[model samples]
Target: MSKFIPLSVPNLKGNELKYVTKAVETEWVSTGGPYVNDFEKNVAEYVKAKGAVSCQNGTSGLHIALLLCGVTRDDEVIVPTLTFIAAVNPVRYIGAEPIFMDCDDSLTMDADKLDEFCREECILIDGKLISHKTNKHIKVVLVVHVFGNMADMERIMQIAKQYNLIVVEDATEAIGTYYTKGKYNGKFAGTIGTIGVFSFNGNKIITTGGGGMIVSEDKELLKKAKHLTTQAKSDELYYTHDEIGYNYRMTNLQAALGLAQLEQLEGFIKTKEENYNLYRNKIQEIKGLTILDFRADIRSNHWFYALHCDENYPLSRDEIIRYLALKGIQSRPIWGLINDQEPYIGSQVYKIEKAKYFWERVVNIPCSTNLTKKDALYVIECLKNAV
Candidate 1:
């Protein structure tokens, strides 16, 4: 047995080598090239977005989106404490503070709690959502569609519109997910907000070695993101700079890989969903161990398979992770609650009840596109016997 049933990994069985080799042969290995533009176009079309801009990684894309949304030092951005730190770090980068919130049953931002948070603790100061505890103006709500399940975006957007706040979606783990029944019926994850970001890291569904993309419906917003990602250069040849910017551009080589990966996005998503179904049918029979549920209102890509430990569960999440580790399986605990982390200890957070509950009990199992039926059965057999 090898200790390498990974939680996630890139699929390079498509046109990766051919395109990357072509880029190398053409001497377009650096940031500027045709593939970069083409990759952006493919993603924008895939997600049904107005436009897209590629960047160095998801974090930089998020920072640029925050800048475009006017997030400043005195501003507060609402975020989920249960999400990966990368989703919230951009709020701090803009000199803005993060106000950690709770998650719902879907493990996404708690939409119901959001309105309650605003009604109880927030005050409208000259048309701003102001927090009395931190004395910061809450300017944006950064909602994450955790593990590819669609967040309750329709309600969240309505709340944003009423509160005079911008909604920035961190759909890094949920590129293909979208609403199926709500006001945003046909909208894709990243396409519904003021701005959205996606990742192409090694462990994502697809990869460009390492890169990201940002999208927005507004042409001006997309333009600003494109300019800022390339160091905010006003002049291309002379390279004159005005405002502070980031060297967050993705290379042509990476874009070439992304272009190849985009061609398989649909197939990758389909396989992932199929794997999730096998896990669910098997795991559901065992009490205290239940597979995550995708919302019926949305068609999920099932990016990750997280098991919730009920009272009858044979072990705690940590115990299960250790058991799987001993059996040469790779599983993971959810991110440590952000509000509980050392750096954000003093930051303001709403009553994050659900997020706190989930942080301790969730264990993410192997869910990769490359997982074969044999591999899935192997995992299920181990899980059934482990308990």
Candidate 2:
């Protein structure tokens, strides 16, 4: 009980040290090495992607994906306001603006609102969907799978196709999540979009310290992503530069750790799913509080457990977080709506009602892969007795 229980942390009990040690011994710890290529291949094969490219981090991957989608300075992307700020920052990285959208009960982008915006607020001219208000081309729909929960891809895809918009899936928190039924049955979260990005941050299901991968079904686009991430070396021997590029390639050391983490990903997901169910059953018995559930149609990674506190709850969301902190348990409130943040003020926003509702009530509890059952029980106990 004295030990501090964290919200999420890496479980590096596998071959991480072994692979990383090997990389160091071989002096292939920088951007170029065998481990980098192996890690990319393993991830692409796991996600059923045509090809994968390694990048410095998820934000960089998203920036590259936006470029590949042809989103320019004259364009705007539709994004969810409820997600982490990293998901929306890439829109501005390319000089494009973001049109924030609301979230549904599942805490993902509301596909219905997206369709409404495109239909009633935009004009399609020669296959280009242009916003009537800003006169900017709406070229991309960037959807984030928040907390490993899959977004409503089926309806979103239909809307994207109708409006000639590119779909980019930010699967940073959903490395192993996939659909089990409907159109995308048997398909992974990142594979369903034109371009998908995955993160290997320390707190993700798996960790490479800090790294990311870009996946796509388009072979040419995948090749271009690799080129753009690697400084666009048309001639590597001569260091010839053709266009603007980023030094966003992942290091061999990070990839080595990533390869090891990827090997144990399925086992980590199993533990996460089991812990999620445990929290769900126990939280239901607590008055005025309950654990949020993932979609019934998909197999989710359950990366973080959301504890929803209602008006009837004994304590407010922030109150519960403070109480848990005093109890030596780490709990955090869900991110503030990105549209309301300082950088995004005055940016276009669709119906943003539901996002604020969830933001004021949701608390992320301890659901790390390394979290013990005793720790989870202790967390729930603290929540139940909070006054």
Please name the candidate that would achieve the greatest lDDT relative to the true structure.
2
Q: Please give the CA lDDT of all the candidate structures.
A: 0.89, 0.94
User: Model 1: per-residue lDDT, tens digit, 1-387?
Assistant: 654687788889999999999999999999988999999999999999999999999999899999999999878899999898999998888788998889999999998889999888889989998887776799999999899998898899999998988999998888888778868888898888899999998888888989999999999999999888888899878989988878999999999999999999889999999999999999898778888798889977788888888779788888999988888778999899989989899888888898888888899999989988888888788878966
Q: Per the 3 Å backbone cut-off, how many clashing residue pairs does candidate 1 have?
A: 0
Judge candidate 2 against the unseen true structure and give its global Cα lDDT, from 0 to 1. Answer: 0.94
- Candidate 2 residue 383 Cα shift, in angstroms, is 1.0
Task: Compose the digit string of candidate 2's lDDT tens values, residues 243-330.
Answer: 9989999999999999999999999999999899988898898778889989999999999888898988888988888888899988
Best by TM-score: 2
Q: In model 2, which range of ten residues has the least summed lDDT?
A: 378-387
Clashing pairs for predicted structure model 2, backbone only: none
> Which residue runs does candidate 2 get wrong by more than 4 Å?
none
**lDDT of model 1, residue 335:** 91
